[model samples]
Target: MDKILLNGMAFYGYHGLFEEEKKLGQRFSVDAELKFSLKKPGKSDDMNDSIDYGDAYELVKEVMEGKPVNLLEALAETISERLFQSYSILEACRIRITKPDPPIPGHYRSVAAEIFRERNE
Candidate 1:
């Protein structure tokens, strides 16, 4: 299977269990891996034959900017669902949502959740 990878997509989102985290907002990073057969697109050499990165990015941005969730797991699941719904060729996908510089006492760069799902193809 061939894959289209979107890595280190940074967004400012209001998502957390804490009140201040949701109110003030923080940086979030997303990495998405979309799996599909690339033979058709590679052979045809056509944009329509393959998934559009711009479209995927826009979808991710929309999900990040539209809702205020309290958990990264939910955010990741939403992203995975949206991708599966929007794209026809995707067989499976994985979404990783990371909260960078979380308001935790311990020194940590980020906290993240990785969710994987497959389409009923």
Candidate 2:
């Protein structure tokens, strides 16, 4: 299958377990891989035959910037659900939600959650 990749999409959101995190908010990065057959688009060179990545970015923006979820898992789930609902040709997807910084007493690059979902599921 062919794939459409969206990467390094950043947003500021108030989503965390701690009150400070919820109040101050932080930066988030999302990387998504949308899997589907691109044969039609590849051959016809028609926009209609392919998924619009701009629209996909908007959907991710809505979820990442809309509600305040306490867990990255929840955000990933919501994104997966929305993608499936929005694209009929999408066969599977992988979503990764990354927090560049958190209110934790540690030295690390970042924390992230990744999920893979198929249309049948």
Candidate 3:
């Protein structure tokens, strides 16, 4: 399958288990790989023949900043569902959500989760 990748998208949002974390908000990074058949688009070089990366980015950004979810898992799931719904040409997708410098007892650079989904064949 052909793929399009969006990486290192940053968003500032309130999402955490702690009240302080929710109030303060933090930075989150997202990466997505959208899978689809690209033959038609490749041949035609038409925007209508394939998914628009700009539109996808905006959709993801809207979902990320639109709601205040306590868990990254929920945010990731929401993104995945939105992507699937927004583009009928998308056959499969992998979404990664990352939190840099999470609040913990010890110092840590980041934590992330990857979620994968595919349209029913």
Candidate 4:
């Protein structure tokens, strides 16, 4: 399997379980791994032969920049679902959403939710 990585994606989003979080908004980071066989694309050496990663970036942006959600888990699901739905060549994928500087008291770098999915057997 081969991978196309969209890493360290940052956006300002109003997504959280708290009112202040939704109102004030916070930073979000996303990392995704798109897994598939690169043979066809590599052999063809054509952009269209492979998945359009720019489209994938746009897809992630649409989800992250769209509506506010109470949990990163849901956000991850949305991204994963859309990826599988939008791209037929993808055999599996991993989506990780991170919330930096969450409202928690303890000092921490960030909180994240990760989801991995493959085509149903």
- Give the per-residue lDDT of model 1 (tens digit) for 1-121: 7999999998998888999988998889999999999999999999899999999999999998778988899998889888988898999998999888889899998888998899973
lDDT of 2 by residue, 63-97 (tens): 99998999999999999999999999999999999
- Lowest lDDT sum, 10 consecutive residues, model 2, at 100-109
Model 2, global lDDT:
0.95
Q: Can you rank all candidates by lDDT, best first?
A: 2, 4, 1, 3
Write down the RMSD of all candidates, one decimal each.
1.2, 0.7, 1.2, 1.0
Prediction-by-prediction clash tally:
0, 0, 0, 0
**Candidate 2 residue runs with Cα over 4 Å from true position:** none
- Using TM-score as the measure, which candidate wins? 2
Compare the candidates by lDDT and give the number of the best one.
Answer: 2
- Put down candidate 4 lDDT per residue, 2-121, tens digits, no spaces: 989999988888899999989989899999999999999999999787788789999999999889999999999999899989988899999999988889899989989998989673
- By summed lDDT, the worst window of 10 consecutive residues in model 1 runs over 112-121
lDDT values for all models: 0.90, 0.95, 0.90, 0.91
Supply the TM-score for candidate 1. Answer: 0.96
Clashing pairs in 1: none
Residue 23 lDDT, candidate 4, scale 0-100: 93
Error of model 4, residue 106, in angstroms: 0.5
* Cα-based TM-score, every candidate: 0.96, 0.97, 0.95, 0.96
Superposed model 4: Cα runs more than 4 Å off: none
